[model samples]
Target: MELMILLSLIGAVCSADITAFGQFMISRPIFCGPLFGYILGDIYTGLWLGLIVEMMWINAIPMGVSVPVDLTMMTILSVVWSCTAFQGCQEAAIFALALAIPFAYLYSEVDLGGRLFNTKIMHWIEKGIEQGKEYRITQGIFIGLFLFILRAGIAYFVFFIVGGIIFKQVYSFLPYEVVYGLKKAWYYLPVFGFGAVMYNFRNIKIPFLRK
Candidate 1:
């Protein structure tokens, strides 16, 4: 329970790093995956999961008004769920990865909603500024930050608890064939991720090299 809370807090901070606060690469799966793994005492699992996720989503960038799936949340949740529930089980980690991907997209939607709400706060700050009240700007910034962290923290906490339970229960029921396939995927997924990375790089138009 305590570990869950700590992970949720970490998730909140990392989630906020996506755009709400620091644009530091701490939000990247490569960093957070190992961090979560180390915290849960499974650095190897964390490292592999992070590397796979980072490579797989190499091109998932947030540009302009677009919101990409939250990779940090996906990676961290997978690491936390797998490590806590199944520790060092590669098959379980892969299954957790499958589960976390959709949740990442869902969180993206939730993040979009939060951004929409932020517009209201922005307008409120604008109104205050026009009326000669400068203090609203600071208040609005803090409020926005607080709300962002709160939303992420709550989401992480719920998913950690609920998702962990679901992963343990469902994984126990998986057939031997399915488990075998997942174990196979444990090796193949990294290669798949490598292919994804190469594909993304292939599409990159180097400015000086562009025709």
Candidate 2:
């Protein structure tokens, strides 16, 4: 229970950084995964997994007027589920990650909505400034952070409870071979993520690198 609560809180704080404050790159999987993994007592696999996902997603970051994929969300959910479920079984880890993609996509929708909601709050903040409400800046920032944490915390709580129960039931029915196949993918999934990230970075013409 302590581990679950501790990691869940860390997940919320790191996830908040995905858009809230200190874009010190904590939102990246390379940092987020291992960090959470460490909190849950398995930093090594978490780091490698983080590296794989980080590399694969090196191309999908948000650009002006362009919404990027929810890479951080997936990394966090995957790490949390992997750490919680099977106590570090490499094979089970792969399927947990595979299953998490849809949840990440679902989170993307809710995240977009939250940002849009923030826009309205921003407008109110602007009005408050016009009216000399000097505290609105702090108020607005607090609201943004609060909403972000609330959302992430709730999502983690829900997914952890439900995923834990359902995945256990699902895993019980799977044959050993199927489990091994997933473990094999665990070794390869990182490769896929790394390749995707590298491909995304392909356009960068480094100086004197045969441009």
Candidate 3:
């Protein structure tokens, strides 16, 4: 219980890097996965899962008005669930990944809603500026950051608790064949990720280098 709270808080802060604050790559799955793993006492699973997610979603970048999947959430949830529920189980880790992807998409929508709300704050700040209340800009910025972290923390806490329970229950009932397949996928998914990454880089257009 205490661990969950700590992880949720850490996740919220790291998630802020996505857009709310520093654009450091700490939110990237490669970093997030291992971070959660280290906290949970299974660095190998964290490293492996992080690498797979990083490669698989290498192109999921947020640019302009396009919002990408919350990869940080995905990686954090997967690592937390897998390590807590079935530590060192590659198949279970993969299953957790399967579950985490949808949650990531769901959180993306939540993130979009948060950004939309920030637009209203933007208007409020603009209005205050016109009224000679320039301090509202700083206040609004802090408010936005608070709201963003609050939503992220709440989401991570709920999902961490709920998803951990679901993963344990569902994984225990999975058929032998399905488990076998997941184990197989545990090896193949990284290969697929590598292929996907290579494919994504195929059309790279460098300024001073040939394509």
Best by TM-score: 3
- Candidate 2: tens digits of C-alpha lDDT, residues 85-199: 7667776666666666787788778878888999998999999999999799999999988998888777776777777677677877989899978878877776777677567
1 or 2, greater by lDDT: 1
Better of 2 and 3 by TM-score: 3
Q: Sort by lDDT, best first.
A: 3, 1, 2
Q: Give lDDT per model, in order.
A: 0.91, 0.76, 0.93
Which candidate would rank higher by lDDT, 1 or 3? 3
- Each model's TM-score, in the order given? 0.94, 0.86, 0.95
Error of 1 at 53 (Å): 0.6
Per-candidate clashes come to 0, 4, 0
Give the range where candidate 2 is weakest over 10 consecutive residues by summed lDDT: 1-10
Candidate 2 vs candidate 3: the lDDT winner is 3
Candidate 2: list runs displaced more than 4 Å: 200-211
Model 2, position 143, has a per-residue lDDT of 96
Residue-wise lDDT of candidate 3 within 27-90, one digit each (tens)?
9999989989998899999999999999988988789998988999999999999999899999
- Cα deviation in Å at residue 168, candidate 1? 1.0
How far out, in Å, is residue 45 in model 2?
2.5
